[model samples]
Target: MGSPKRGHHHDLYQIEASLKEILSLLSEVEIDHKVLFLNADAGFDSENLRQMLEKEKIISNIKTNLRNNKTAKNYYYFDEELYKRRFNIEKANAWLDSFKALFIR
Candidate 1:
């Protein structure tokens, strides 16, 4: 999930509510143990979401840009190798853009 752009007024509570609903649906399907790695495009950096994921005991590998003033004081685990794999998403996006359908109005 992408975070709202800076200066855009968005309610984080709404996003959290939607995330809860989605999680509930997934749980109803008997998916109890799932490694949900959330990758954001340097925009969806929210400590609240991270806390929520931790509270639910879900393993998340979320990317956080360190351009902001806020810093992480606690030790957090991250998969550097898996983070490298995120480049594939960009490659896939580029491949999709090669299709004329994506460019058409």
Candidate 2:
């Protein structure tokens, strides 16, 4: 979900705004199963985001830069198989395009 922050004020991540959005999105998600993990790509690798997700009891499996395995304070276990899944955004988008309901909105 990384994007050039579309608002006039520019930053890679406005920490406060990102926090609010995380909380809001968490609230909206109704978990039917035990939600043990939240996987994100290296772009989302951040200590702040990891800590927040920790507090909420979700395992933050954010991929790190090849040299930054220690940045997130050793709290997460990097699953290579899961991290590899983030590389196929185009396939996921194509799958979504196959669903007619996604075009309705």
Could you estimate the TM-score for every candidate?
A: 0.58, 0.57
The per-prediction CA RMSD against the true structure, in angstroms, equals 4.8, 5.1
The sequence of per-residue lDDT tens digits that candidate 2 reaches over residues 1-105 is: 333466566232675566556566656785322357766777677777777667767777777755566454565588889767766866788788788676786
**Ten residues in a row with the worst lDDT in model 1?**
1-10
Task: After superposing candidate 1 on the true structure, give the runs of residues whose Cα lies further than 4 Å from its correct spot.
Answer: 1-13, 33-35, 69-72, 89-105
Judged by TM-score, which candidate is best? 1
Clashes of each: 0, 0
In angstroms, how far off is 76's CA in candidate 1? 2.3
- In the predicted model 2, the residue pairs found to clash are none
| lDDT, model 2 | 0.65
What's the lDDT for residue 43 in model 2?
A: 64
* Residue 55 Cα positional deviation in candidate 2, in Å, after optimal superposition: 0.4
